[model samples]
Target: VTAVIENTAGQGTNMGFAFEQLAEIISQVEDKSRVGVCIDTCHTFTAGYDLRTKVVFDQTFAKFHEVIGWHYLRGIHLNDSKKELATRVDRHNSIGQGFLGMEIFEVLMNDPHFDQMPIILETPDDTLWSDEIRLLYSLIR
Candidate 1:
């Protein structure tokens, strides 16, 4: 079974706000090989990990790799945050319509590291799902 680590909005002594915490949690599991991580973009951004730029994105993932290792990266919750970077607020908006913008999504879509991982959308607008999906697919190249 995979252990999907979610970042908290700093609501009240909540845990998993940092990648290190997720690494520690996964490390404590007896069978580490069976465990994996699900990175939610909005939560991560809310937790203060900036992914808007390539340099920052690489740095953030580098930290994740340093702490948790890339083998445990199993999935991604592809959502944009309504709050600004490091706001510690868990608000998800539609793709390209939030603080995260569309650049990061395009970068992720083309990144070979996440090639086969499932990228799920958690945007608030149900009406824009089709359009969002198409936009994501179009960025695959």
Candidate 2:
């Protein structure tokens, strides 16, 4: 099953808040192909991984690859955060309306890694899913 990491909101008791935790879990599994991750944009940002600019996006994802390995990435949850970076609070906001802005969404919309994966939207407004989907598709280069 794919292990979706949860944000700790600057707390310490939780184990899956970090990518390293997922890596550790994967390391213990005998059938490596059975394990994978689905990164939530809001959670990852609030957990302290930045995806703002292309440079920082590369760096943050490089770190993710280093710790968790890209092969284990099975899916993505696209949600902008109502909270700021490193605040650790998990709050879902509509795409482009929160602090995450639009560049990161544009980047991910065009990223090859996400092209084949399931991208679930966690935006607050269900009525806007159609518009959001169109907007996201428009971001593709």
Per-prediction TM-score: 0.94, 0.91
Q: What lDDT does model 2 reach?
A: 0.83
Reference-based TM-score, model 1: 0.94
Q: Worst lDDT window (10 residues) for model 1? A: 3-12
Residue 46 error, candidate 1, Å: 1.0
TM-score of 2: 0.91
lDDT of 2 by residue, 1-141 (tens): 545443343545656668787788788988886777878889888888888778788898899899988888888888998999987788889999998889999889888988888999989999999999999999989
**Which regions of candidate 1 deviate over 4 angstroms?**
none
Model 1: per-residue Cα lDDT over 1-141, one tens digit each? 566665565545777878888888887899887788888898888899999977888899999899889999999999898899888888999999989988889889988999988889989999999999999999877
